[model samples]
Target chain A: MTVEAREARQPWILLTPAVSAVLLLLFVPLAFIAVYSFWLRTATGADQVGFYLDNWREALGDAFYRDILLNTLKIAAITTVFCALMGYPAAYFIARSRGNKAILLLLLMLPFWISYIIRTMSWINILGVSGAVNSALMALGVITEPIQMLYNEATVILGLIHFLLPFMVLNVYVSLEGIDETLEDAACSLGATRWQTFLEVTLPLSLPGLAAGGLLCFVLAAGTYITPLVLGGPTDAMFANLVFEAIITQLNWPLGSALSLMLLAVLGALVLLYNRYLGMAQLMKGLG
Target chain B: MGWNLVRVWTLLVYVFMFAPVAVVLLLSFNASQFGSFPMTGFSFRWFVELAENEAILRAFRTSIVLGLLTALISTTLGVLASLALVRYRVPGANMISTILIAPILVPEVVLAVGLLLFLNFLGIPKSFPLLLAGHVIFTLPFVVLVVQARLVGIRRDVEEAALSLGASPVQTFFEITLPLLMPAVLAGGLFAFTISFDDITGTLFWKPGGVETVPTQIFAMLRNSISPEINALGTVMIVMTVGLPLLGAAIARRMAAGRGA
Candidate 1:
């Protein structure tokens, strides 16, 4: 081949392995699920080879699945709010600091280096009925009975916040870090109070991070299975947990795929909405 | 200034971040069988017990292999993808990058189950290579992102200069580009390794029975109560994940400083 043709062909050649893998493994499998969502499963846990919309029909019509969807969205929304509320101040503090910013950022990321399952289970030892918190509370005469704090929405939220808070903090920190400190200083010199300057200058710029972090938290919370498996009770199962139950326990692949699609659709909608409002570039900046 | 509010908030936030890990590490040393309640005297008994556990040891070995292999595969693909994106003006480059990275966006559970079903339909048994392929799918984005950041500064003139001196394309890549790109390549590989090693959701769904990675073993162990062996495992993993990366970052930073100076 000529040099120009060789150069032209090189990019495609280099990309062949990765592109094929995505097409085969990620994209095609997801497409398989999309097709399987409309098919029926057999008694032997295999999908029948005919197209039908029964799975989607049942998923859309069933109050049980509807409740799971709503509960998943609700839990995700609540978790996002809690993470943002807790993460914003910490991120702001780190961003506002002059030196040791890298150190603080590293500290925030330390927890994420460990296993997700281990971190979720750690709450059991700390929050169980006979665990440290209840035992300490009982000793202090906070209540006669140890509070039922282990398996509920409260515990689930706490676990999610613990897991997701670092992401939020990191994203918000990136956004705040990108803001020109001189602008805030200028606002202050123009007679704006510290609060006023923060309100008018800093927070608006940090909105991109807030939106990105909030989206990350929402997606994670909505799809979390393990945390809820370990920390939540029967009543608090999210849609992912339902998907897990349907596939692993009930052997309902068709229903499971349908639920998976629903979760994916919901998350995709939120992401699109976020991009429309906050700009995809800002969210993309926080990901690496 | 009333920024003491911010100061106290910072302290509380740090406490919240460290508390779970500190508690786990403490309990890992507890002498009592019940993970709950009063601690008996601290001992190294659990750490010792972890050494005798064959399953955990095997899982650790498997994990190291998996991590290394996944890192290799993903970094190769990622470096190639990065080169394609940076060096060539291709149609749909942005769209292609987005699609390649979309694996990170999709929930791990969805990817896992879908892959499981897809493999089953294809009649491919879950094996080591399959597991590696799955891990590569999840981690390729990290490698690309890390390398892409570093690739931008590498001027096109350097390659052209090498070529003008009669070097072949491959020679130009190795003798010129690869050496310069080494730091970023290593960083990307490290990210891929760490991600594959710590993977839980995708690993759990797609793993063949009787073949347990560290996380899967830990999952099984947690069904009872948190054991000292598991604690030892977590502690070791934490050290590897954070300590090694920091060490590498320090070395890279030193190299950069020396070059600049």
Candidate 2:
């Protein structure tokens, strides 16, 4: 082959293994899930191989699943809001810091490396009846008895916020960093107060990052069963929990497949919509 | 005054971020078995207990082996993919990058169930290899991102310089290109290791019965009952996972500084 042809072939040869692996592993398995959703689980727990809409009907039509799905979305939405509320000030602080920006950014990223399960479960040690807050409150004589703080919807949201806040902060921080410092000064010189300048200038410019972070936090929080399992009360079962129970506990892979695909469609649609407008580059920047 | 308020808010946020970690660390040294605290005094009994636990030890070994394997495979494939992405205009470039990283986009539970179903459909047993494949798919993107970022910053002139001096394409890759990308390659491998070591959501599904990584083992132990042993284990895990990336970042920083970037 000519050198140009050899050059042309190199990228394909280099890319093929990774590309095919993704195709075989990620996309092909998604196809498998799509196929599995149409099958039915026999009374004996054996998956009956046939195109049946029964699982989809039950997954979509069941009031119990519907309620849990809505609850999950609500919980995820709450977490995203909290993350943004908490993340913005912190991201702004880090982004605007002088001499310690790298350290602050590194600190922000520190929690991201920790195990998601570990991070979620860590809330138990802090909010459990015998945990720090209870112990400290009891010491202070604020209450004679420890308040029940663990295993509640509130705690579940807290766990998710703890887990997802960094994503929000990082994305906002990246966005904030990209904004020229002069713009804030220009706003101030043009007779805008710091807060006014921030509201009119910085916040609007940073809105894209906020939206990106919100999308991410919502999708991740919505998909998580771990935070709920580790921290949520018995009644706090989320949509992903239903999917997990169907597959792992109930041994009904068909129904589980349908449930997961339902989730996939919802999340996948949101991701597509986000991509259409904002692009996944911001997500990548946040993730990396 | 406003900036000071923001700084205080950031400080509190940092405290919030570290509170659980602090609790885990503090309780790991608690002499009490119940993990409740006040004045039980500092003790290393949890650490001692963890040191002697066979199941935990086995799970730790399993995690290490799995992480190493994941790091190895993810780094190799990710580097090649990164090179193709950065150096050449690969066909369907946008789609290919998306596909490569799409594993990260999908929910872990979804990916777990899909992989489990896919393997079952093919008559494949849920085993270590299954777990490894799930992990590699999840982590390969980090390697791709890290390596590709570094690769983008590297000038092509050096590689071209090597090529013009009678060095084969392979030689230029191995000698000129690979060395420049080594830091990122190593950092990406560390990321893969850390991610695989800490993964639980997917591992819980892909694992065969009786097999456990540390995270899975911890999950089992927690589900069975919370013990002080878990505090010790959690502390250890926090240190390892946190330390690995910190080390990776530090190395990258040192190298970048060395290169006068």
Candidate 3:
């Protein structure tokens, strides 16, 4: 082989192992799930391998599944909104601060680095009937009884927000840091008030990061099984919980595969839409 | 006044972020069995209990071994892939990079279920090896992203200089490129370790019968009953999760400073 041909061939040789591994493990499994979704599961917990549309019809036609799917999206949307609302200001503060940025970022990241399960479990210590919030409230005469704070839709959203807020903050902070100082200065010089300057200059400029963070948080919140399992009530179970049940508890792989594909399809559509408008590559780069 | 308000808001945000962690830390020391507040006096009873618990100990052992294995496997693959991506002109490079990192974007539940179904279909027993494969899939993207970032920052001239100085491509890579990439590789490995160690969603689905990682054990414990032992486990996990990255960062910073000096 010529030197040029050899040089051209080297990348393929180097990439083969990792690429093949990913193809076999990730892509092949996904393809399997897609195919499995079309198969049948008997009442006896055995998979009947034949092409059938019953799983899709059952998953999509039933109100129970529809409601669960909608609830999952709603919870994810609410969690994303909360993360953005809470994260943007903190990110902005850290970005604008003249010093101690590292410490501030570390503080934001500390909880995030901890296990998601542990972080969700911590809420039990804080939000349980005899937990900290109730104890504090009772002491202050805010409420006479310990209100049920854990095991609710709101608590599930809170858990997700806590888990996803750091990503939002980090992404927003990256974009915020990328903003030229002079643009804000220019807006100020043009007689815009601080709020006006922020509304026009800063918010719009940092929107890419916000959008990226929001997408990520939504995807995470929508797909999370542990948060709902631990923090949510029976009624608050998201679509993922159903998937877990069908696969693990019920041993109905066909139905579970169907639900999994449905969830993936919805999330995939949202991501594709996002990519069409704002390229995923650019958004992810901004995230970093 | 506005600046002060913003500062206070940021402080409140930090408090909100750390409140649960603080509560967990405090509860770990509490002598109370119910994990309720109101000062039941500090004690190390939970830590002792945790140390004595065989189940938790076994799970901890599993998590550490799995994490180490994942770090080793993913980082090696990630370094090679990143080298191809950054150094060589490859067709479909963008597409390849996207595929590699796609796992991070996909829902963990979807990945877990898919893997479970795939493994089951193939009659691959749900074993540690399978779980390790699943974890490597989940974590390889992080390693690639980290190492790729570092590789991008490195100038091509350095490698070119080594090549011109009678170093073969492989020798140049091992001597010149690998040394430069070490910090990134180490960071990526640490990230992979932490991710694999904390993985509950994937581990829950893929772990074989009777096998448990720390997070899975903790999840089961929490579901069954709340205990100070769980608190102790949480405390240890928090320390590891927080300490490992900080330690890695410190080492990387020191290494960078030494190179500068």
Across all models, the iRMS values in order are: 1.5, 1.1, 1.2
Summarize candidate 1's per-residue lDDT along B1-261 as a digit string, tens digits: 647788788889889878777777887787877665667878778878888889988998999999999999899999998999989998999888877888877887888778877877788766776788799999988888888888998889989999999999999999999988888888989889888888877787777778899888888998776665666667767778878788888888887788679
Q: Which pairs in model 2 have colliding backbones? A: none
Error of 1 at A204 (Å): 1.1
Candidate 2, DockQ score (0 to 1):
0.79
Of 1 and 3, which scores higher on lDDT?
A: 3
lDDT of 2 by residue, B12-95 (tens): 999999989888888889888686666388899999999999999999999999999999999999999989998998779888
RMSD of each: 2.0, 1.5, 1.4
Candidate 1 chain B lDDT trough over 10 residues, lowest sum = B225-234
Error of 2 at B86 (Å): 0.6
Q: Model 3: how far is B72 from its true place, Å?
A: 0.9
Reference-based TM-score of each model: 0.95, 0.97, 0.97
Query: Model 3 chain B — which ten-residue stretch has the worst lDDT?
Result: B31-40
lDDT of 3 by residue, B1-261 (tens): 777888888888898889998888998999877666776899998999889999999999999999999999999999999999999888888899888888887889899988888987788878898899999998988888888888889889998999999999999989988888889999999989999999998898899889999999999888776787888899999999999899999999999889889
Model 3 residue runs over 4 Å out of place are A44-46, A141-144
Residue pairs in collision within model 3: none
